[model samples]
Target: MYDVETRQRALALVAQGRSLNSVSKQTGISRAAIRSWQARPTPRLRRLAPCARCRPAPGAPDPADSYAYVLGLYLGDGCITRPPQHRTASLRITLDDAWPGVQQEAAAALRAVFPDNAIGWARKVGCHDLKVYSKHLTCLFPQHGPGKKHERPIALEAWQQTIVTAHPWEFIRGLIHSDGSRITNWTEKMSGGQRKRYEYPRYFFTNSSADIIALFTDALDRVGVEWKSAHQSRVARNISVSRKASVALMDLHVGPKH
Candidate 1:
């Protein structure tokens, strides 16, 4: 059987008006499997408004700190969906269920962006999802596209560019909070014939999209922070910053997760 992700992608492709044959060829799944998924009953999105009238108003100013941070988070681990028969579209961000603070922050961001929208959360197996619905998500985060982000081109709008450039550190903090992590590193040292332990802190961000990585690196550069890639790979890029001074700066700005 095809995995859940595969089934979802196949259905999305078909929803976009692509033929079953094209989706089968692109995803390497059989037409029969794709057809089966299509035939299955589609589940109604829970915690969502019933109709377009229930959706929040769809206009918000651009280039604000909250706007930039939410955009960053969305770029990292979020998805937008608009069903053909549904009158409202939804924007969802999935976060680790263990991190309630992250979930709160995500909900706060959605509320900040769409003050009139009814924002809500739901539990998945290992994660919680934050959702908001409005036509404005596409306008605010134009980078949303079909298939996977790494397989498609992602470029910020001119207004978004202005916001990110103006608030690079907040943007980076949001990115790190989503796709990146901060951790303590330790090593054993021998000094004067005695074994000693040394500990330090570091941050690492991982993503499959080259453009997103570039955007991250550029933000770091703009903030005058030093970082390096853990390894060179096209499939997934890993970046880290561990210098004491740099970490100090990041800690002052981004702080730590509660």
Candidate 2:
């Protein structure tokens, strides 16, 4: 086992872009040994359970239960709207029609797709007659105009079915775009004191397109996706290159072969 001081020094050298071999030479540790140490998992802090008196007893009402209940409502027949401030409370009264059950089925499908997310639901009411909004409607035709006041009730069940049938890939592919957005979020700091963070290493992959393809291919393989690559035209317009000769190569024709 390496001492804490030695590990810290080795990590510092690695962070400074020092090669593993160079670090091993300076620290008198084998490169393989250093690599093994780096691979070891660090201890994590565990949260202690609250005292019996402070904790909610089994079967007792919990805040999470309320949220879950609201989620059920939303999943069933709830809607979103800007209610008037004067309204005391809005009750989501489902009509005797079969729409509520249909909505529930749709919600079940959505739950199957994203089992980890805690989707919530609620209905809105106000002094002014208003429109209702549902996730089902938005997920289907994302280009639909914004919710308007004095609109009739939307067919939540039909909308949800349309969404699932039309864009099954939308759920998964949307995550890729979201990952890029998350990276942007990490690189750009907010006005508040929150620290910018990244989920992956900045230099984990190489700069070349081929390297990127290799990295993604490896990732796809891990995910059990079959993929094939083919070379395409390298279209370049206004890109800055450090070397003029490298820029000239971009003008040359590259055959379509990968």
Candidate 3:
């Protein structure tokens, strides 16, 4: 006898647009079994609570600070996948395995915004995928759509922009945690008749999406941080924060990943 949990898991994959054969193979359930289950509706053992965005008032998400951070992470590299047939959609944020603390903080932020939902972790090469499923993912992230984020036009809704404005640093921290990094570059300098090595730290954020880069820079501006930007390729660009004052502010709010 198959357990209900196993069946729901398979259905969730199908809802994500996975092929029947692939889902069957991954779940170790035959296509016939999956098809049979699909034909007949099985009630969900657990139903997720209504999303804040789905509420009648439809106000900004509660614990907006956490929402701001998660929004930054999502804009950097997060994705929401859902097939029209299913009500539930999944929100996935890719996190580096080297920084377990960042991963934990990300999970905490997600939970704060999405309390009463199940959060899971999937392992990938050198990174971990933090995922949660909900009916209102689209409502929460109006940005979800087909194709790559860079290929499509991305814009923030007024509500989201308001949250980012209120919690700019958290938003910046989230973006940096997902797609930004800090590095120290050193060069030899002639001082007092001797060659000495001088090291300086800088923060860089790279994204193919121009809108995302603009959003990051906007946050930096709010915090009085200066940045320099350059295009690395046709679709990708880098934003660098190298000024001593800017780097100092970033260090206080977002140091190198733990």
Candidate 4:
């Protein structure tokens, strides 16, 4: 049996000159059911307000995979701006101009965190930026300290660490998708007494922040995806998964960029 409120709504729609068939189609109630509700002696014809789900709920949880992924992206390539008003802040992630999929993924991740806020994108000189503004954005990404991430003391909260622990692949995907890449390495070797060239796929994650790099490596360790430092300079730290097995695991989580 349908809820009394839903039956009343169907009867009300039919009373509003809507065809029974149309009301059935619009409300997902059968024409016969609507007719039956209309013929009832007391149909509880009270007006119904809009559904609660039509509006997004306030204060959504901040420790889910989507939130964790966006946090990873933020630590990698995102920036947060706080206005003097101190009421709202905007988070923006800049993706390479050639990588539209990364930009879309950032926007989708932001939408997941702030379902009610609008996600915007713009083209810069050599990159695309995805931006979203909300008071909650600052709360979600509290690591948005001053200057570069490397210059600041960046760290994740206990809840965020828990999320990363639970969904390491998503965190890795977000980090690599933003600041890392899947590249092919070529090598030559003597095979059958003849020189041969072979190319293999590997994943690279480079970041200015050592803390962020550590977080990435920690996630990789949890998932048993082996990685090692690949940086030649001290200014930035780069990590790579070059082993065939590790590269295959990274590929499973984060495929080639679109």
Q: What is the C-alpha RMSD of each candidate to the true structure, in Å?
A: 15.6, 28.0, 10.5, 9.2
Off by over 4 Å in 4: 1-63, 83-87
Error of 3 at 98 (Å): 1.2
Alpha carbon lDDT at 151, candidate 1: 91
Per-prediction backbone clash count: 0, 0, 0, 0
RMSD of 4: 9.2
**What would the per-residue lDDT of candidate 2 be over residues 1-258, giving only the tens digit for each residue?**
777678778867887999999999999989887776678523211223332223454222122222223232332233343347623222231322223443353344444433333333444342111122333333322222334211323232443333323332332122221111111112555547776654321111111233223333443344333434332335311111222332232222111111
Local lDDT at 38 for model 3:
85
Write down the worst ten-residue block by lDDT for model 1: 45-54
Per-model C-alpha lDDT, please? Answer: 0.79, 0.35, 0.90, 0.79
Tens digit of per-residue lDDT, candidate 3, span 5-53: 8988988899899999999889899999888888864535446556777
Give the distance in Å from residue 201's predicted Cα in candidate 4 to where it truly belongs: 1.0
**How far out, in Å, is residue 12 in model 3?**
31
Query: Would you estimate the TM-scores of all the predictions?
Result: 0.74, 0.19, 0.79, 0.75
Candidate 4 on 1-258: residue-level lDDT in tens? 787778767777877899998998998888887776666524135343222223255332543788778877888888998878767788889889788777777788787777666688877899978988776555567697778889988888776777888888888888987898999999999999999999999889898888898999999999998888886487888998999899888878889877
For 1-258, candidate 1 gives per-residue lDDT tens digits of 556666787788999999999989999999987887677533331233332222475333532778778877888888888989867778888888767787787778777667667788887999888888787667667787888889999887676777889888778877887888888999999999999999999988898999999999889888888999897686889999998888998899886665
Name every residue pair that clashes in candidate 2.
none
Model 1 TM: 0.74
